[model samples]
Target: MDSSQRIYWTAFYTKPRNEKKAAERLTSKGFEVYCPTRTVLKQWSDRKKKVTEPVFTSYIFAKVDETSRLEILKDTSIVSNVRWLGKPAIIQEKEITEIKSFLEDFPRSELAHGDFQAGNKVQIDSGALSGQSGVIRRTQGNKAFLIIASLGLELYAEISLNHLKKVG
Candidate 1:
């Protein structure tokens, strides 16, 4: 990457089960990559119980110097795409920090991601996930999983129930 150009986060397609592999390779080479994941239950044939695994599979966000875009994208195991307005998506470091903070602050059961079939639009007015907006996907018993989409990727990440509510 050229010194004058800036690094931006981008979405990549990885070989099945290759998300961790891609991240390891890029970060080891001095690139910043993010593969946000959460554990979910996977029902197996041989087991009566479920296994916890990644929510989003084979997808990651990477930051590459504008100059290194070409070289960095040459990995045969990963395919890349610019996600922000045709340019590589520049995810503010602060945003990632906030996400990390949220994970540490909230328990896994506190987040939810379901179809918003019956809820109100909401804006997270404050806290780590402030500025996020979504509709209540629904509640399972007493817990809720407010659904919000990452504007950059247009992909949804279930957020903390306490962070959202009816907007109007």
Candidate 2:
């Protein structure tokens, strides 16, 4: 592929509860899409059942070149490309791989939104996210929610306290 056709993994926001549909539509149109999902046991008054849900509620990633990027916007389910600093946010391939590996290893993990407060900077000393540095966004019990910022996007993960060391 030429420079203009070089594929980039770009993040996009989908309409509410339309992640899977958007992924399917984009894939059918020959776009490589990744809609990370995990299976979890959901309990209702009647019974418990396993359900698969998107890891990122309304977000999906697509591999698109410069021209194809615009084409994706034409899809009704796709709200728009995730932008940071007035440009499309390009996600790194390694980060996407890490997310997939994390979901496989921790299928029951939960994603939560916490207050965006300034906190100490720390580096992961061990485990899957080892060597990654992020600000400790929040903490509850033994888990610390970290915001790892890259390419103007924030990747949030709840990590064990034992795996982090406060950066000097």
Candidate 3:
């Protein structure tokens, strides 16, 4: 029974795109839950609408103590065992927090990704590429990729909000 209520990598089988619902159910049970989702733009005949979709498909995260494993397993929405190396895996709370933070702060921070594409000017806002200029790309999910336009190649790295800032 850790005070942090350590996180676990659960291999839950959701109801075919019902991951969010399942996560919510578990959350209400007093378990710390995480289901990373993003709003995707869908163009309809009438207009464009942003629909919330799960990033990891059927996967969801939960934080609990060892004693709660049985209750979690008994959960109606969670269909499979949480796993790691052939056993129920215990993921540290730190990793869950980091991923959550990245999703939340994506708007303000700069982003970088590997593989360059056309018409991108290279710019590196952080790391070895920091302060360097490169091709910038406005990609899906508000992610930006820095590439070398001349080479038509993107830097071989994918960074989220954690290590991103637009180069001045």
Expressed as tens digits, the lDDT of each residue in 45-64 for candidate 2 is 67656678898999999988
- What's model 3's overall lDDT? 0.61
Give lDDT tens digits, candidate 1, residues 32-68.
7777665433334453233333335877777667666
Put down candidate 3 lDDT per residue, 16-60, tens digits, no spaces.
777898888888888777888876554455765667878788777
Clashes counted in candidate 1 amount to: 3
Residue 40 displacement (Å), model 3: 2.0
- The estimated TM-scores of all candidates read 0.52, 0.61, 0.56
- How far is 162's C-alpha from truth in model 1 (Å)? 14
Give per-residue lDDT, candidate 2, residue 54: 93
What's the residue-level lDDT of 47 in candidate 1? 39
Model 3 clash pairs? 110-164, 116-154, 120-135, 121-134, 121-135, 121-136, 122-133, 122-134, 122-135, 123-134
Off by over 4 Å in 2: 1-3, 109-168
Best by TM-score: 2
For candidate 1, report its TM-score: 0.52
